[model samples]
Target: MTSDPTSDPTPGSTPDPTPDAVPPTETVRPDWAGIDRLPTLDLLRLMNAEDRTVPAAVAGELPRIAAVVDAVAARMARGGRLVYAGAGTAGRLGVLDAAECPPTFGTDPALVVGLIAGGRTAVTAAVEGAEDRTDLAEADVAALALTPADTLVGVSASGRTPYPLAAIHAARTAGALTVGLACNRGSALVAAAELGIEVEVGPEVLAGSTRLKAGTAQKLVLNLLSTAVMVHLGRTYGNLMVDLRATNTKLRERARRIVAEATGADRDAVGRALGATDGRTKDAILVLLADVDAPTAAQLLKASDGRLRDALERARHQGPPPA
Candidate 1:
């Protein structure tokens, strides 16, 4: 809980604990806290119930999440990047969200970057002296020459991680839009950003180990942030990933299926269209519907700036090509 600067910690009369970095130890415990004594089935049920709370907690923050997404989409539409910064579980979540964007929405990797305090090594294994150093976060953001147009999101379960907050502060200083995602209400991290998203998931199941509910909330929030941002950027067409890059056998097959699904065409027809456009779904769709080859389709896509609907319409209805 937060308090006024002049407020006392005691109910009636002491110093408030608002400045604390770690969550305080609680007096009350869950009835099933003593796990060693519980039956296996009972323990599993308790865990599942706790897991179910995560989604609800995330749902409560949708309004704030939507605001952040609109700001991010506006910046990206102007040609700026989106960057994620965090530590530990939050850091890994940031990295995972950024990594998945390339394959899922077909964005360039450079468009969305994730920076963890301990670098790539901290992703799998723990690294000491990482999150404590805000300077490192500051330096990383500084080196990127992050401009006023970019969007920087900092994730921290505790709401007090120095590294993440420092990144947020640096991004704001550089004139970029900043967002802070934390699991505590009225967190300092939240206060640091122009926009704050706090998902109150309560304390962790494991005492002092925030990797439980806090991590779950962070994961869910990150998923929403990235997915919503992608949708706003026009990466999806009619609920389908029409711009996906067919880089491998699996993705190639998935791309074909997506084309067939989105175009209401047969698998054979989809394959022929895909072949004509060299495996580009949007291009192939235009080629089939407009009876054009890859170059003409690509030119049409350029004319429409990657919005498949506009490209297809122009390809079918536009005046003769310019001399």
Candidate 2:
């Protein structure tokens, strides 16, 4: 006998009749069926094994991540900002990454921006259905005053969150380059943006709790995106964070070490250079490596668009300071 189309599918049968409708892997994990009965040790082991798969998933999306990084760097070089929008874990991750940029890359606080769906309060406590509010996302992007030169990245673990989808649409309308980052393939978030990065991390061991492996994958991707873009923008000198703003004791010591290591200069020489450049690590390195005075080093850096390697080459071509 034929079955009723509207009736629920029997256990182990197809849940949805639509061929194009597939359940998100995040909501279906066969291995987690008897997880509640497992011992604490075994549960931890299972979680760890599942967590190990996150890096591999991220690795598969490296090419796409590289593309986004290059695009973001190009825009940033033209005075554009990198903006990230999302909700919950995704939003917190964006905020954390943006917060680190200032001290890590010497970027202005306004350069990298993170907008959460429920505003500041959402970062710590859940805002209750804020992720489903598309209007809030639109308002957040509008307040940014986006331009064509800016790049906006919308992050969502489900890939169907209304907040990020709305932000992506609003950002695109403002002529900003939009990138959608999601953990599921063929998501609305991905389809709506000019560039999409989907890292399929599969199901969570705890069932629907995306803050586990999915969160890890998002963090990994964000790390690569921001770090690579900064590297492309000359924020580093051969893997060293030359653009670091040494605001505290630890960073101040790091700045001195970076200068000494980059220029083979002694402690006193590093201190002198740091003082001359007002604790600017890149300028100190340039001053020492180019064997030029502070003013000349600053000029060379400015001429080369703050690229240390380019400034060094220019200084080399100019020959040694008049003996």
Candidate 3:
């Protein structure tokens, strides 16, 4: 909760003469006054009702989200990276999404990056005054060495967070595509970037605790952004993650099931196909569906830029590689 300037001032610290207008996420709801007096069930119901409004707020930003996804996909197609920068809850969310991309969509760990204000330690513990450090933000962006082919998304609930704003400015200066994701409109963070997505989730149930609805909105937006970009980059085949990296026993079993589902093959055939392809699910599917050897399937996938559907079409048209 933010301190009221009129109520009290820190020792030896004078309040600013001109305070900025309160952000929607920071504003208290008059109707929610004395919410502490409510029963547990009533409180739960109130919070749940507020949570339901988040999706509609996100829905209103669809066109903006689509544009950012297309832009990010094009850059990534050329080997560029997608980076997310924020602080606190926003920062943690970005890191989580980035870390998941490799296992879920078979992307290089370096291809999607996340930077939080105050470095790695802040991810688990609060680093006091870290979010206010613009220098740290600039240094973080500099370390990435971003290029025009890269995209950086700055996330914040208030739209005025100094860390993400500075990071966005530094990325823009580096010729990278800059996008701002915030829960409030007309924010400095939004104006600093080339593209802006504001979900406008309004006030949270507990007033300024943006980690509730704002965090949810940011997570949803990041989900849409990363997932849709992967789809456009051919990491998926008809809603299936064709490029999934199965690194564990469960994932290995999943890989077999996916190959079976895609090829309509029995378990034995799936096992044989997976073995021939070295357990590569996409290659196994291509080998079965296109009636090609493992080596030919690999070549087709490479030619089609790892797009399973395209490789299958090419293989069908070319008949079979030499017997």
Candidate 4:
């Protein structure tokens, strides 16, 4: 980060946001001259070694990452959604993370969303310089009917991308919680977000090609952000993913193991309980613990606001007050 938080080393948010600020060359390399003669395997080895350093860059942002998790968790508890907005590779990564939330945490599809400039088609194909437009970012969020309770995360490696920064500013205007993630220090993208996480991984091995170390760093940070938020939302019981949606055969087996592990029950017993309760592990646990039927256990979960421990504690302390 720059010693002066107000100064943006990136473009768009700064008055002197010239092309020099976060120059494209910082992330890209001229591969045509040297790559024509080198062995493909040698080039692959160099890329792999560069990719290995991304985790350490992410590790440096743990404190900022925790702040994002806490804020996102609070917003979610209030019925606010988490929205990831970006352009280019950063935008696609946002989409990827949001797409995974449903099966991993049993969250409603709308609860976590992603918006990229140029829309869904842009995810797989370049949309002819879409990231340069600032207005598109604002328009996408407006279409979502954004609320103050929502949290918007903007991703950009250069920290100067017009689309992501514009969306962050717009999200803030709606009183939503905002987070900006970039790979450059004192980025305009960071300045726009209420909480900025800049993981400076330095220049890429391939000259200015950001898809190298910088892209890896952003992916790791995003993984931490979403995973931590899920943990805070009670999606897990101890180390077990009690709320995972078992869609495929492998996942069903994983779910059975989770229930058995949590309850100290055999696979047959676990399967029966889970089947009876519509494959809900938490509900099955409540039924097993309270010695009650499915509906009764479900009502307890509802009354306790879906907090498993609280529901079970209330069940245990019933029939009180002998005067």
Candidate 5:
């Protein structure tokens, strides 16, 4: 007898091919199915509404983020490096944040490293199958020569990307702290790392395109992580970026303003103090606030481990600078 094509061969077999599909939370929303048919204004409004939820989702993870930042700061104070590894949009964001560290916090370029699955070429265009290569991730971590002092952050929107998972494992094996940032909960990437940060931004408005809300969530988390770490490491003085490297005309002007604002010093004194310190903002601030020569300010800063507050306190305890 001929069998029906639609009939299941086994008694308990499912006819649907994709039985173990992605969870509904990660799958595309049925409400957004008609987005293409909506008017331009409505479409824009809908997308904007979806974007608004991202920040709250990020805010919910603040306690965890703080814990990671504190841990990273302690390690970094011991000369540890912050390394970010991922693929695709997540990778690009990591690279962008790493690149910005130098000018923003006067960090050495090598101090915060970003490694993408396909290297530099994958930043602009997708490389075929690069994200699936776990070996490449292992090799990249090995090249960094990670130690107990370093912290590695693996970013993946889906949380199942092989590249970052492997990188996390490799980093852990090398005695480094590992963190996983993903938009989905209970992901393999999160399970493998020492710390797991799942933002849970929900399904995308564009149906699985995570570069929208998920990407924004990642950016916000990264901003918090790096900025908080920098602040904890004494890179900032009273919300001012004292460690900024003034590499351009605008930054130089900003540096002078920062000195004036920080110490309540006159413009002329700011200029003179900055000149005395060779345009180093932190040293200039110390020179003005501590009432000491540039060299003395440098020594005090070194003694205080570059903490402006501690240096000021020590300088105050020593009384006024000798005439």
Candidate 6:
């Protein structure tokens, strides 16, 4: 039998025989018997077919995901932070999402946080019993000093994992918005959080290996949550990532293309606008489109709260900030 990836049960330990105790993600499918005996191509096909079902499972939870997105956006607008906490693959995914926000949305790294159960060490290697340690979860949360304006998302495929469940409780107690992203129905994590998102991806191709379908489901929901919230918070301008940080050569080129596309400016004009605005794509677009100087574009964007659309409308109303 395939062992649950989230936990390290004692060697030769028998699974609890209670039917209700077994989550669908852990239930072994009789049809998948002798999957190892199949040819390599057939094995690949089986896994591919299973992977295709993840999107639909995620779709089934869109309403819940939307609710969480709206709530997170509202909180973040009020100076709240978004925090993700989990263990193992779930924890790694949370950290990955949080790390991308700075480059993707030009957000402060501290604005979105990811906390794994075993801390930094667990990120690269397993830490025995870390998932079962509720104290670690509480301490990690305490360090955040979370307030009502904050949000903590507990990610756990099994739903019953102690780490994320503790995180949800801790966040809720602090009056922060609590969201549980889980793969099992009627899970403790879902029921405990103020907002619950359960994307039932069912059993994995390898039976109890939640890192397959369950991980995919969590990732899809997380992408939806973070991207939608960022959009609502004015991180994008008409589907363009105007606030992206051009920290690398590729991103710098992308910034130039963004400015040109947004303003229909020539390459030279785009380069000049970007130069004038200190390489800020949104400011460059405003400089080209609003017929304003770089400093005036900065002031306009500041007044409009970094929203390119709002700044443009204000620039039109004010008529290019005098001479």
What is candidate 3's local distance difference test score? 0.90
What would the per-residue lDDT of candidate 2 be over residues 1-323, giving only the tens digit for each residue? 12355776443232222334443645767867999999999999999999999999999999999999999999999999999999899999999999999999999999999999799999899987677677888889999999999999999987877788889999999999999999999888899999999999888898778889889999999999999999999989998999999999999999999998899999999999999999988889988888888888888888888899988998999743332
The TM-score obtained by model 5 is 0.91
Q: What C-alpha lDDT does candidate 6 achieve relative to the native structure?
A: 0.89
Comparing 1 and 5 by lDDT, which wins?
5
Off by over 4 Å in 3: 1-18, 319-323
78-174 per-residue lDDT for model 5 (tens digits)? 9999999998889999999999998999899999999998899998899766777777888899999999999999999878777888899999999
Q: Rate the local accuracy (lDDT) of all candidates.
A: 0.81, 0.88, 0.90, 0.81, 0.88, 0.89
Better of 1 and 2 by lDDT: 2
Question: For model 2, what is the C-alpha lDDT against the true structure?
Answer: 0.88
TM-scores of the candidates are: 0.89, 0.90, 0.92, 0.88, 0.91, 0.93
Give me candidate 1's TM-score against the actual structure: 0.89
Once superposed on the true structure, which residue ranges of model 1 sit more than 4 Å away at CA?
1-32, 319-323
Tens-digit lDDT track of model 4 for 1-323: 11144554333233335544554327445553475467999877777876787788788889999999999999898889999998878899999999999888888999999999789999999885578667778889898888988999999888887788889988998989999999988888888789989897876776767777877887888888998898887776776787789898998888888888878888788888898889988888877877777787788877776667777887788621122
Kindly list the per-residue Cα lDDT of model 3 for residues 152-259, writing each as its tens digit.
999999887778888998999999999999999888888989999999999888888989999999999999999999999999988887788888999999999899
Error of 4 at 147 (Å): 1.7
What's the TM for model 6?
0.93
After the best TM-score superposition of candidate 4, give how far the Cα of residue 106 lies from its true spot, in angstroms: 0.3
Off by over 4 Å in 4: 1-16, 23-36, 318-323
Q: What is the lDDT of residue 143 in candidate 4?
A: 84
